[model samples]
Target: MRVQDTLKARQASIRKVVETAFKKENPPEASEIISSPHLEPLQIRDYFAGKRWWDITFQGLFDDYIGDSSACLTFMAPAGVEYYLPAYLLMAVEHYYDGGIITEDLAYRLKRSIMREDLYRMSLYSVEKKKAIVEVLVFLLKEYGDEEALEAMRAVAMHWGSDYIKAGGQELG
Candidate 1:
């Protein structure tokens, strides 16, 4: 087989493994808790137990995706790029913690959408709305973040370089 074909086969095998793992039926406890909207703090705590295990793997993938996208999208506008990373993280959390808990299809779709120009452009709401969006993202990071991830997110959020939107500007500045 050609080297490229061999590599493709290996990737497909690995992807199947990960997909099967994610698609396993959730525990009754997790499903029950996640299905209910009004969870007490203790209930929330219980629901999130062991979730960080997923975070360990997910964070590395998240970093890799972000790095690849940044390099690939260098020619694209950066006005709302920073927000996309955090928002993607938030959506991943929502997908895992709320939406049927886990599905590899969702994971794949989320990663594929990360670098789309339109996704960031869709975030170009009003200035006040953008500020609110940032605030919500800060809250999500505080809730789900580890030290390294938080620092990376903070760097993205506070970046004021040429690529980043200026303070008080639209496009999630």
Candidate 2:
């Protein structure tokens, strides 16, 4: 297979695992999740999109999916993207995606696997936190089982890297 095709296969395989895990575990119900004080009315409505109440509850679902499960989307550095990105970085990616806007440089950082940067500033875009975001999402995704909910989560998660989390809970600027 061509190099590009080979890469695509790997990405697809990753998403499959995430999706399966979500279907089996099924995170907390939508009502409980939407009620989170962290999200405002607008965010809740947008998340629900008038579909099902128990949808897109696990913010972590998105994180894990792209953490390494998907290629089209990621928060971690691939083989040569930036030397290397850790598994926890996936959680950080979800955090930034949920709370902040990702930047161009940060996105590039996720694409590469050699330009390893600081983890503390990942959320602020200072060091690029896609890794953590993806990690968190993966952890959460493993808790959900509803297909609709998983898809909704993916919608938000499909746009991050898998290399944004700091190791050992280090402080960030």
lDDT of each: 0.34, 0.31
Clashes of 2: 57
The TM-scores of all predictions, comma-separated, are: 0.25, 0.28
Q: Per-residue alpha-carbon lDDT of model 2 for 85-112, expressed as tens digits?
A: 2222322223333422232123333423
Best-fitting candidate, scored by lDDT: 1
Candidate 2: C-alpha RMSD to true structure equals 15.7
Instruction: Name the runs in model 2 displaced over 4 angstroms.
Output: 24-30, 36-42, 49-173
For residues 1-173, what per-residue lDDT tens digits would candidate 1 score against the true structure? 69658645644443343333233232223332233344342343242333432242344434433333222212223332232233233333343344222221233332233324354342343444333333333333443342333333334344322122233132332
Clashing pairs in 1: none
Model 1 segments beyond 4 Å from truth? 1-96, 100-115, 118-120, 146-173
